[model samples]
Target: MKGLLKSLLVLALLITSMSVAAERVHLGFTVHYTLKSSAFSAKLDRVVVTKVNQNSPAMRAGLFPGDVIELLNGSVVAGASARKLDAEMGAIRAGDTVKMTVLRSGKKVAISMVAGET
Candidate 1:
């Protein structure tokens, strides 16, 4: 009975560990900051899409290079720092829905994508 209990415990632990393992998300896009500089402080002007990988989630979602990011997950991107944006991206997990509003050719466009496995 003790041996059986130990085996069950081990199985439970293994299952728990597997379930606890989170899958990182891959957006398959790259972005660069557009900064407005001054004598005192450099402020974030915009976040622009630098590249979109072929067949990636970003590409599939209609994101294009030169598109200026306006919103992320329904939040304004204008005042957000680069570190904060990176942290927010890092927090995204696979299967999470991501939404963005971008400026393309002076028009605002919405893009939606599901986070995919890294």
Candidate 2:
């Protein structure tokens, strides 16, 4: 039947496309988890720290570019980058705690800090 043929083609494509996803995962080292939302967007992935702007919020918070954001809130950050953390931070505001998790030195840790402008 035509319907059965179409389903087989879809399955074949799905199986072949999985490799591309895996390659993307291997390209970078980042762990990001985004809560459900359609209005907000962010690209979160493992970042290698090559520099930390002088006197920047990141420096003040003791986080650098290499620090991988492994989790947001309590969820595992394993897919679909959306680290636009700085962009969406306005809602959180200054002096409010931004609960975050990170993968540092192969260890998973939770940390919280007052939200501040970059």
Candidate 3:
């Protein structure tokens, strides 16, 4: 009974998160996690930008493919779980300012853009 209740709660939260993701403001970009091997630590997940649509806020902000995402909305992206990342990203609404930090040419660059309609 307790297990069933917990499962239901998890399912409810998952559904809510998915709905938010489905309605999230468009960023005109796409990303995916890449495995990065470290010497001291275990493998790490790095969020890499795969594409940026033309004339989009992301493109205007200078985001480019091959850039590694370091931060989103001032939050660290290095160790965030995929679900948490999705929830945070999905929470953005149109006109909301989105801040990001990315690694390009081995240097960190900060960027800000307003979310747009999907």
| Cα deviation of 55, candidate 3, in Å | 1.1
Candidate 2 lDDT, 5-101, residue by residue in tens: 4543443232112133213111111222223434553333342333445554445556545456665555545443333332233234444565567
Candidate number of the best TM-score: 1
lDDT of each: 0.69, 0.41, 0.68
Which structure among the candidates has the greatest lDDT?
Answer: 1
lDDT order, best first, reads 1, 3, 2
Kindly report which residue stretches of model 2 are placed more than 4 angstroms away from their true locations once superposed: 1-51, 80-90
Off by over 4 Å in 1: 1-22, 37-42
lDDT for 96 in candidate 3 is: 80
Each candidate's number of clashing pairs is: 0, 12, 0
Weakest lDDT window of 10 consecutive positions for candidate 3: 11-20
How do the predictions measure up, each by TM-score? Answer: 0.74, 0.43, 0.72
Greater-lDDT candidate between 2 and 3:
3
